[model samples]
Target chain A: MERDDIIEYSLHAHHSAEEGVKIRKKIYFVTALLSIITIVEVVVGVFISRSANEFANPGLWTSIKIGYIALTLIKAGYIVLVFMHLGEERKHFKWMILAPYIMFLLYLIFIALYEAVAVGHGMTL
Target chain B: MSGEASKTIESKVLWGGKVSPFSISYGKMMMWIFLVSDALTFGGLLVALGFARHAAVTAGEFWPSSEQVFTHFPFTHAHLPLLYVAFMTFILIISSVTMVLAVEAGHRMDKKKVAFWLALTVVGGLIFLGSQVWEWSTFIAGPDGDITTWADNATLKQNFFLPTGEMVDGAAKLGQEGPHAYAMFFFFITGFHGFHVFTGVLFNFIILMNVLGGTYEKRGHYEMVEKVGLYWHFIDLVWVFVFTFYYLV
Candidate 1:
């Protein structure tokens, strides 16, 4: 079937070669961004572990650990926003999909960490 | 009177005619719901991991450090920590990019470009699956020649030599209970993620077959490709969390 014959709702119409090229550039851009982030993560993982020594002073190590989590979250956000096309979604729809889950996850993590620490104390006592 | 009666009858019907409040197609909306639920499932597992690790720490048990554990790279015997997993992450991320491209091509009604990018996406997924398999085996086999006592015995040992030759109390040994708990959690979490990746590969393969068969061509729209792209991207997104919880953090 030809594009003209299709009777369906679509976000964009048929495009020329220039439009295709533009999309290709965007794809490469996303790829490059993800690649650089992954590289920075690996670099940090290797060097920070060597320099800080997670066992010696866990406090310093933890700050570095927080940095890793931040980077990972950033990467995750980018993938969800761009690759999943959630960024293109209507704002209300995006919030409807994302907000509850984010809040719930935060709650779960908090409860788990707190309870785990309490349990550890019990075991030690 | 006739017009008023007809309007009353229309309002009385069961279906709401056009109730897509989100302004998205039914399939896309359904995919979003599934993705949200799937994300929660992963969140639960990761939270459990955090609990386990924290408890081990509190009880003075040995919890294995991910950096020390995932140091093996492919081919060369030298320990290149996180390199292989980084490669796997890049493969998955690039595959996600290809999936977006396929969706864009679908928007343009460019069948050839859609098929081409979709094929590359599938290949990327396959490579990632293969890498995960290798990683699982290497993990199960234990890191490079029994570097720790836990390798020989599942029991957590208090003392193990770090890659830097510094001796430290392994998290498994803190409570004097051994590393079995740590190992079990590691296997279960990564195995679960791997299963998701496997299913994702299968999903992509089916979609690719349909694309090759020109099913979308006949339908006049490649919305099916877009739907599967949502799923593919979800799989990648889950891996981002898993990678952080399992390896990086």
Candidate 2:
């Protein structure tokens, strides 16, 4: 019996050579994008550390930190959407998978920040 | 059976008992559910880390910076901040790409290509795991040279010395202080992430074996690769969060 005769499910759509090339291109694009973001993050990190008294300006440091977080989130989003094949999923399915997590993450962050501040204050007193 | 009763049953049991409400395969949907729960577990750990760091900082104690703690790279005594971690992150992201490629190949029923990409993905995972091991060892052993303080009782503290042999601030003690708290959280958070990476590597190896054995070929679909790919990407995604929360922040 042929190897192809026993299989039952079609998890992926049929693709042509052009589609294959497109997929490979997408993979390269994702890799390059993630690498660039990482480089930017490292450069920013090293730069801020090397600069004399950069931390003295709390505002500037906070902004840089926020930028670092934003970049990381972007990289993660790209990885999930493209590499994880979430982007190709149906709209409702994507929402079903993502919405609850996003809401919960926000809630957790709020609770953590609030409680941490309270703990900090209590420790000081 | 009456026509009305039969129609009602058919409507309720969609897709001939497959019952995929979201139109995804059972395996893929289950994988997504598992990933979501795993993500929440990571989230809880990270949030705890955040709270711990916040408490330490608010207490006006000395918190050891990430650069100070993670400066050592493999085979080099130089102090390169974030470089090794950056390499680890790149390796993981690249492995994600390779896993996607394997899925793509599977879509085409190209067994050879699928196996090749899966092998590369496994290699990438192994390299990442090895790097983590090296990192964990360096963390546990800490920097050389002990600094002693003469208090009521003489205590020996391991100071993290720079390549130039200069000790960082607040490096001498490790009991309920800022730096100590920082070290504890660092160990816990990164250790947890490293555990996931280890498991992911193991999972990739299992899937790779299946690929090489032509199990997928026999099954006529590479859905297994895609399922594992989802898991592998989740690991990379969690690392992105860990890298940000622990290292960059």
TM-score of chain B of each: 0.82, 0.80
Backbone clashes per model, in order?
14, 0
Candidate 1 local accuracy as lDDT?
0.75
DockQ for each model: 0.45, 0.49
lDDT of 2 at B138: 63
- Model 1, B122-221: lDDT tens digits are 8998899888877766655544435354445321232133565443563322334335676677778778877887887788789889888998887677
Report how far residue B220 has shifted in candidate 2, in Å: 1.3
Candidate 2 wrongly placed segments (more than 4 Å)? A1-8, A50-54, B1-16, B143-178
- Candidate 1 has a TM-score of 0.85
Off by over 4 Å in 1: A1-19, A50-52, B1-16, B142-160, B164-166, B170-178
Give residue B229's lDDT in candidate 2 (0 to 100): 88
